[model samples]
Every structure is written in C-alpha cells, then in structure tokens.
Target: MDKQTMLSDEELVKNFIAGNVTCIDVLIDRHKAKVFSYIMMCVKQQELAEDIFQEAFIRVIKTLKKGRYSDSGKFSSWVMRIAHNLIIDHYRKQKNQVMVSNDNYEFDLFNSARFSDKSVEEKLVHDQILSEVGMLVKMLPDNQREVVEMRHYKGLSFKEIAEETNVSINTALGRMRYALMNLRRMMEERNLSLTLS
Candidate 1:
C-alpha cells in the first residue's frame, strides 16, 4: 500500500486539518462503499441512498473546513452517523407522511411509500408539513426516537429493531407506538395541521 493509503483515518483527518485537503478525498474514497451500503440499508432506495451519501460527505467537508472535526471516533462511524440521520430526515420529509388531528395523527402505511400526484402548490404545502414532522421526530425521547426512526425510516422489521436496540420485540413495538403518539401530541400542541390542501 502507498504511504497515504497506510495512514489511518484519524491520521488522514489530522493531515486534512493540517492543510492537506486531498487527505479528505482519500478518506472519502476509502469509505464511500461502506457508507453507501449502510445508507441503502436504511432507506431501501438506491437514489435516496446516493443523495444521502453525497450530503454526508458535504457535511464532513463543512465540519473539517470549520476545524470542528473531532478525532474521538472512527471516521467511518462518524460519517455513517451523518448518513443515518440524513436518511431518517429524508424519510420524515417524504410525501404522504403521518397527519396530526386533535390529539393524534392518522397514518397510511402505503402512503409513506408511494409518491402522490402533487402539484406545485400542494407539493410545497406537503414539503412544509414534512419539515414540521421531521422537527417533531427530532424532539422525541431518545429510545422512542431511535425505535421510530429505525422502524419507519430505516425500514427495519420490528424483530430487527428489537435486535438492534438490544430489547424485546414487544418493547420495540411499544417504543414505536409511543413515539408516534408523542409526535401526534406534539403537532397538535403546536397547532400544526397536515391538511394543507
């Protein structure tokens, strides 16, 4: 292996911090496939995964440029964290998301997956609703948020979510249920309506 290739991720990060911008490129080139695979695993859509992959790198670049890149974790893990959040955020921003009523939201499992025939006006309104939903999801309690993100955004089965969370399947289901309930309450309390048509 070349000397640059032999450098560890932290070392590359340090080199980039020391003004060797190309080291960041090496870091990205080395980790792109694994990051893309993880994003694809979460989103189940190649195009969305690719967009998240690019966004993750853009975030990395911005952080490094601001000299805020921390060396405490594996660079791959750091990048994956960014990619994972972006996937979940994208999930919340998709069309036909959950809609809040008086104290709860109505859901259509199929709507979350299919694109609606939205016009410019409706699409803009829908985008605004998605942004609101994404914000509310970010406000959820940690465990509840994790479960909801994995089950809905990551597209994990309840069993898979349980295994990943190191919990029983029932616990995972309960967390997801509570998360949705919490999101519903949040939207109503904030007076955000999903029927923006």
Candidate 2:
C-alpha cells in the first residue's frame, strides 16, 4: 500500500501546504468522489456539477496556499462546505433570473431525492409545498427563523449552527425544536396540507 494513501486528510493537507504538491493530488483522489457526488446530488446537472467540483478544489487550494486553513482534522468537511457554498451560489444566481409570486423567496431545503427524477405533476406539487413552507419559515421569529434557515436551508449541523450563531448546542437544538413547533402551528392554523392527493 502507498504510504500517502494511508495518511489522514489533515496530514495530507499539512504536507501539501509545506511544499509537497503530490499530497494535494492524494487528498483530491481520496475525496473527489464524495465531494463530486455531493455537488451532483445538489445541482442535478453533469456540467454544472463538474464546474462546481473544480471550483471547490480551486478554492481549497487557494485557502491552503494562503495558510488560511485551520488544522481541525476536518479537511473533508471543509471541502464539502466549499462545494456546498458553490452550489448555493449557482442556485442563487439562477433564482435571480426567475421570479416567484410570494412574500418569501424559494429555497430548495429538502435534499431527499433528485428533482429531475420526479414526474412533472409531482415536481409541481413538490415546488408548491416548498414555496408554502418557505413562506411559513419567513414568518418565524428572528432567532427561530435563523436557526431554521441554517439547519434546514443551509444543511448545517447543530454544532455548526451553534458556532455560527454564537450559541450553545443545546440552545441551537431548542431553537430548532421551537421553530418546528411554530411551523406546525402555523400550518394547522392555515389548514395547509403538504401532502399531494
């Protein structure tokens, strides 16, 4: 077995930053599939996914070369985040070209299945529900709304949310709990059915 193949991602990153160019290749080879798959899953387009995947690595290389990467032993997670952000930026740009009639902007919060896999009727229903839910989320209190957006829309973990919001994990979880309850209450009051008959 190659020694480089056995090195941890963090170790590979350190080696890469310390002038070992091949270490970056090993890191990319190890994580390319997972990172590319995530981008494909989110964007659902081959060309776009490839572009985002490349851009992610470019950003990763730039960050590492600039000594901006912290040694958190989470190099893969950090890479995935960069890819995710690129995907979000792509969608955000696309969204600006099209307008939806609603108080709140649309968000592709659900990551269950590929949108392209759905039938036309199913896709329409799914989009309607997503828009409705997005509006409901907009109506939540500021803190709860922030939590919901970060947790659901951004696909952030509770720990990440806590850190980003400068709160404890327990507090982040509590906000998510209350946000769900409030969304449920609002849905019930509006007699909204998320299901398609």
Candidate 3:
C-alpha cells in the first residue's frame, strides 16, 4: 500500500496543487472505476463513454491547474457531476446535428412505434404533446431541467437523481416541484394546449 494511495481526496488534491503531480495520478486511479462506470451507464456506448470520461478528467486537470478547485472533500462526487454534464452535452450536440441534417426535423418523442399500437391521429396528438413538453423542459433552469429529465425521461427515482447529481433527496424533489410550476406557467403564458380535443 503506497502512502499516496491512502491519502484522503482532499489531501491528494492539495498535494497535486502544491506541485506533486503524482498525487493526481493516484486520485484518478482511485476514482476512475466509479466515474467511468457512471459515464458508461449514462451513455451505454463504450466509445462515447470513453471519450466523455477522458474529457471529464481533462476538465478536472485544467481546473486543478488553474488553482480553481475548491476542497469540498467530495472529489468523487465532483468528478461524477462533470461526467454527467459531459454526457448531457454529448446528447445535446448529437440532437443538434440530427436537426441540422434533417430538412423536416420533427420532434418524435417515441422514435419508433414498434411497441405501441396507436392510430395515426392518436400518435400525432401524443407526439405533439410530448414535443411541447420537451420544449418547455428546455426552457427551465438547468437544475430544474435536470431533475425533470432524470425523473421523467430517464425514469430515475428521486433518490437516484440525488445520488447521481450529488444533491440531497429533498433538493431533488424541490427542483422537480419548481420545474413543474415553471412549466405550467410557461404553458399558460403561451396558451399551449396539450389536449387531443
């Protein structure tokens, strides 16, 4: 057991900031499994996950080198958050590319109807409602948007959202609550009707 391996995360971060570069190697080695697993789980593609994982660590290294790292003593959580954000960014970029390449870019919540047995009219109504909701979700504040997307789209429970986001369960719930409120207000302001009437 090397001494650096046994050091606390904060201690390792401090040492790294003080010019002991090997401490960062130790830190990365210690947390890589958890961080990489998280990225892989979100992305579900080995190549994409690997890229985001590397980018997350690169951002960490840059932040640390710039003396911008605040010692919160939760380095693992910080790294996980970075990886999560990177995964979100990757999806957003992919979506933008799709929209750009497709001349008739319609938002299809259900990409395929393989499992659904709905008539064309019903499907169109459902798709329109989902598209409106998606636009409203995008307009929400980042934290609120994250909570809503995780809970509804990703089907994660509040506890899971809290764990993944490094926030308290109550905080996650609060974000969801506020997100709903904001979405309702936005819908009313826009006179958006999500009904099939």
Candidate 3's C-alpha runs over 4 A off are: 100-197
Q: How accurate is candidate 1 locally (lDDT)?
A: 0.83
Question: Which residue pairs clash in candidate 2?
Answer: none
- The alpha-carbon deviation from the true structure for residue 51 of candidate 1, after best TM-score superposition, in angstroms, is 0.7
89 Cα displacement, candidate 1 (Å): 0.9
Q: Model 3 clash pairs?
A: none
Clashes of each: 0, 0, 0
**Candidate 2, 47-144: lDDT as tens digits:** 88889999999999999999999887588999999999998899899989855454464655443465336889998999999999999999999999
Tens digit of lDDT per residue, candidate 3, span 1-197? 39999899998999999999999999999998789878867877778878998999999999999999887659999999889998889899897886423345687555566535788998899999999999999999999999998877655679999999999999999999999999999999999987777
Could you tell me every candidate's TM-score relative to the true structure? 0.49, 0.52, 0.52
Q: Which pairs clash (backbone N, Cα, C closer than 3 Å) in model 1?
A: none
Sorted on lDDT, best first, the list reads: 2, 3, 1
Off by over 4 Å in 1: 95-197
lDDT, each prediction: 0.83, 0.88, 0.88
By TM-score, the candidates rank as 3, 2, 1
Better of 1 and 3 by lDDT: 3
Q: Judging by TM-score, tell me the better candidate of 1 and 2.
A: 2
